[model samples]
Target: MITDRLSLGLQLLRIIVAFMVGGYAINECTQGFSSEKWPTVKGKVTSSTIKEVFTRSGTSHHEADIHYQYVVDGKTFKADRIIFGGANFRSPKELIEKFKADKPVEVHYKPGEPSVACLETGVNFTVLIPLVAFGGILAFMAFADMSKSMQPNSSIGPRPASNSSGLAQPKMQQVKGIILFTGLVAAIFGFKYGINAIHFGAIPGNAIAIVVLVGGGFLFVTFISLLPAAAGMLARARRFDLAEKVAKLNTKIASTMSAHSYETAVAYGLQAEIAQEQMKYPQALELSKKALNVLACRPKVDLAVNKFDDSTNRMIKESTIRYEKHYNDTESLCNESYGSILFDMGMYGDALTHAEKAKRLAQDNLRNAAAPDQAGTKRALAGALALRGKIELAIGSPENAKSDLQESIRLRKEIPHQFEEYLAASMADLASAYCVQSEFRMAERTIEEGLKIVEGSNKPSHRLAKAKLRAQLADVKMGMGQLSNAESLLMESLDVREELLPAGHPEIAKTYLSMAKLRDLQGKQRDAIGYRRSAGEMLTNCFGPQYQAV
Candidate 1:
């Protein structure tokens, strides 16, 4: 009998709290809308004071206590309420200053009841706290009841069926619904409170608002992070589709080529050259072969067989030479494209061989021509130089890498329309080369120039490059014995790298290693060890234990 009574009492309390919360919410909502249409009157603040109240735990909080008189319908009324549903504020200085004695302010009052007056119309802590608590309690109770019903042999009859994953599908749906609903409620209140805090210009209120906004933002990011990785897969699929399209076009153009149209062949050859420049080697190779086939199919008009003059023979020979040069240029670019792709794939030896071959072919072409293809020759030379520099650096040949990188930089500058991103990247690599040679000041200056070029760009590649340059700068600073500046730059680099790269990326591991070095320089032995351990673990996870040597 006592157990039954206790259960009954608990149920009664839950129902009462639920009703009270519902009624409070409804009243506040009605008053909020009603206030918009409420008549305004000039009111004088008769009295205003700061009141301090202590909680049961003896923590004191302050509130502004203001009494004002407003005349409505030719009769004066006194009211203490500042805003509908608002409780005592944590810091009431702003409110107190606003409601000084004899200060005239606008008062909003109900049409029939002049006693119902408010300075503002909004739901506040007075309503929000109870509403949230009671709502949460009700939801918990419902969830508990549902769980009890779902158990085996419960009086509530058969439970819902579960899916193949052994989880009740209905329950999963309910959980998702609850989470989404709670998030929506939090977002709405967070935004409303943030705007209100800003509107009132309350310092403490603004702090609370910031916390709410940040929490809401984190929740939003977490929600988005749960989405499927469809976008990345779709992008990869699209690139493959484009590559296939290029292959098909090349085949079609190859089969339809005629003997009389060398111009058409040259156009396709240029297209192939462009594809090679973009590092699409498979497409470039296919197009280059097709262009070569078209050139081979051109009519062989020999002057000896046709009994033509020496001038005509010379003209024919000149045209053939031009065609052969174009074909050789396309071939060289295709080799360079292969080299670039190999470089990106970390096949250093293969990349170096192809890069050298492309460089030699471009040089030979430039030497033989009366008027060289200046742009093509420069592009091929610069690309080969950059690739060779990177390969040398990877193989620990700092002097060779520095020489090639410097030459590449000079060549890139000589080009009329310079590729800024590539130039900045080469500068960053050159800075790293300088760092490898312990040329701290030169490394710092080189990276600083690169940063100036890329710092303002929002592209991910630019940002990633900038992060890498910052890490190199940090290393240079460390070499210079500027521990404090090195630490700061490393931290900034880590932030950008973490934002740009995926977790456990090699770049992130390198940044951690730099941070460890900085900590060691600063005499933080414990922190240095910890950072080094983190770097080792990240590198091991990303590239196996052998790569953790750094």
Candidate 2:
């Protein structure tokens, strides 16, 4: 096939280029610094000239030419070598003054070869190091290819099949590309360091060395970080084996949270959402509880309240109001988060209870406060409303869900700077509610708007959100009896999810389910069955065999 031919061509090109570059570098190194035993003699300048040359690009440069005669082995020798490895440059006037007619200067010449002589003798820093480093990299690639070719077919074992409970394996091609790019960057830095080291006397050697060392250190850390991901792809181990990896990632996240106290509660709340997706209900609950506790214990000190007059008890009143407002806002957020997790776990009643409490707290804070946090209050209220909408939809109340979602979307748009991901999610939920009512056109429009909002965001999370919106749009299309459009959208959504997410992720499974439905609508029973089986396997891995969806 074409792929095999392309691979073979690339391998051959690498081998050929590596050998050619390596040979040239070796030749230059050997010729430049083979032996430093050249003899030096006094030479008299015979002639000197300098000229300015301009190219068609309108760039002008200067060059100096000088001729000298030296007595080597009792024979007069005429030479014009200014440097051993490369040409040297000087101003026209400087060259003329330095190399005055009959002026004596020192010259270094090879003992056995009088004709091969130089005014100076040493290695060339500008040429040797970069070529050698580049050549070495190419040579290594060539050697590696040869080694791979010689290895037995059995030595290269088959990759493990992806299982439901296992993390998705990254493509080997992607991994290799990352590694190669990183190696090239490291090699470039090495070549620069080599150049700098050769000119140690002319540059700040210590500073350059420190910079190179720090750069190399960062590259090493980056490579080490990618190792676990690459290894996961190779092993395709079950979820049970991922505990340590998850812990390490969580530790890093915790460290980041420690530096941003304002985000701690929300961070934990988000983690709880992820736990729910992994089918760990108890863990999700525990995480949400921790988020609530964190918010409760968090201190809120308004400097403005403290700066007010203390004699008239104004400071005390303001402090109390500020504290109450802050407390209510935080509580509302925590409650909304808890409700959302409960909703995911299919506890509609419990979720609705928390959602209502959140909504009430937010509204009360808005009504009673002298100067409420309008942004915070709106966000809390919107979240609560969205949660309630989701719970209502789950309990088969499409009208109530539609009303709440509309209100939530209205509140979100009122904010000057809204969170894109949340807005997209709320829009998707609203579209889903519309779909339940068989309002396919409205659902399609809502989801398309959500997709547009998310498409402008460059964040990885936004990409996943966009994929979900696309899938929801596909659902609307399917409901409207547009099978071709639905199939195209579903395939697009699947591609995005696969590129952005690990194998067997819940979103990927959902995309597969949608694809199965599309295939069934198209009367492709065999393809539909295959897609359904794939979705079921993924769901079983993520949510366990007893998962209702499975």
Candidate 3:
């Protein structure tokens, strides 16, 4: 009887809160800012009354007991719960009078459960269930993972999920991320509660609640003081949330993992790639070099494995080849990415040096490639060749560019299974080589093929490649004196590039330069100068003051 009575009290509380929310305000809250997308339907109130349920202690709970019916597919369902006040009524008495008889009302039904209806829709009580469900699943998985990692190992085997220094590794970082996430959510709720308590001016009476809240906030701060937000990094890193990417990567490096692990090296390499894309050349060079430094993991890996039993050592030794190949592949890709950064910095000598290193290392690693991992080695090799070709073109060696780009295209074509975007990229570079040598017709054909490849592939990165191909096609059209076609292609290329790239990215400047060329051809000399000046400023900002615009 007490359980049933308490349930009635809770339902009365819900009704009282909804009634207090005010007329039409609930409608705005439901439709304007509702997190859930609810479909609306027409309904009418059949009955309305105010009722009081008394407890054994003679305490009474007053609520508006209103029943409404809505139809779906010729079937009708009734609900007595009032989500909020309706019909321009400001008070419960007004609601009772307004809803005494049949009155049309708007109803919002749960998408999958049409029987479940509400007078007004907004973030309801069920929202926390999703958060708790997600957090509980992650917490359980993380706990289970830690249990496995906690298994006893030989004295020589540093903990499997951490480094020798006992700090969390990348794998364990995620495995422990739930604690931080839960603490963050707890802290937010606690802070909100404390604020409400103070607003209500319930001192001493709400003092215990405030203390519990303070403790929760402290735990949250302790976890977050470990990072700007540890949970946010785990959440947004894979989503490619650009605003938080570098900051999260920086936090990932600083907080949990050792600076020298292979995973940490990958993080550094990723930051370097981002820096290069943002046109921060000096920082990108430093970051890529740091990635290479951290990737020198051979001695540490070998030493750790040597401490095991002979049979175990031998088995681990057999797997060392895989580690070595991964190391080489990462190094080659980083070198190629660094070379491109240098090429943009106008450090042609240094750019060509690293470009050759990337190409040589990629070629050397190919001997270890078998069918299982052959695609990765070939991808690194093709990427190296493509970067070298671009660098060679910048150095005024068209022949070398042509040779390298052709090899990149040929090698990439063999891996067509998952490499359409890459093949298209290499073909676009080859088209540039042809244009540099005044072979405009060949350039047009190569670039058109590149565009066709991108259009057919449907890869997420296809639009980026298509933009480059269109830009190349524009240059070829200009060379062929098809000014109108050239202008059209430039506009298309510029639109895509501007949409996809950061404001200071090199490709955007290149598109601006093409625009300048088009304006010059059209005899709009002043507009040409304006475009040229804008392109020059952007390139200068990207590559620093040392860079000279073509």
Whole-model lDDT for model 3 versus the true structure? 0.63
Q: After superposition, which runs of candidate 2 have C-alpha atoms over 4 Å from their true positions?
A: 1-267, 270-282, 294-312
lDDT of 1 by residue, 281-336 (tens): 46655665555565556555443523667778777667665655555555455466
Candidate 3 clash figure, as a count: 0
Local distance difference test, each candidate: 0.62, 0.65, 0.63
- Report the candidate with higher TM-score, 2 versus 3: 3
TM-score, every prediction: 0.43, 0.50, 0.54
Best by TM-score: 3
**Per-residue alpha-carbon lDDT of candidate 2 for residues 121-225, written as tens digits (9 for 90 to 100):** 555657645655654554455445444433332101232344221112223334544566467556544543343223111112364366446544543443333
Give the Å error, residue 296, model 2: 5.5
Span of 10 residues, lowest total lDDT, candidate 3: 1-10
Pairs with steric clashes in candidate 2: 164-541, 168-503
Candidate 3 residues lying further than 4 Å off, grouped into runs, are 1-255, 297-316, 369-372, 416-419, 456-460
Question: Compared with the true structure, what per-residue lDDT tens digits does model 3 show for residues 143-195?
Answer: 44444344342112223433433223334556565565566456435533343
Residue 36 lDDT, candidate 1, scale 0-100:
59
Regions of candidate 1 where Cα sits further than 4 Å from its true position: 1-334, 344-346, 501-505, 520-550
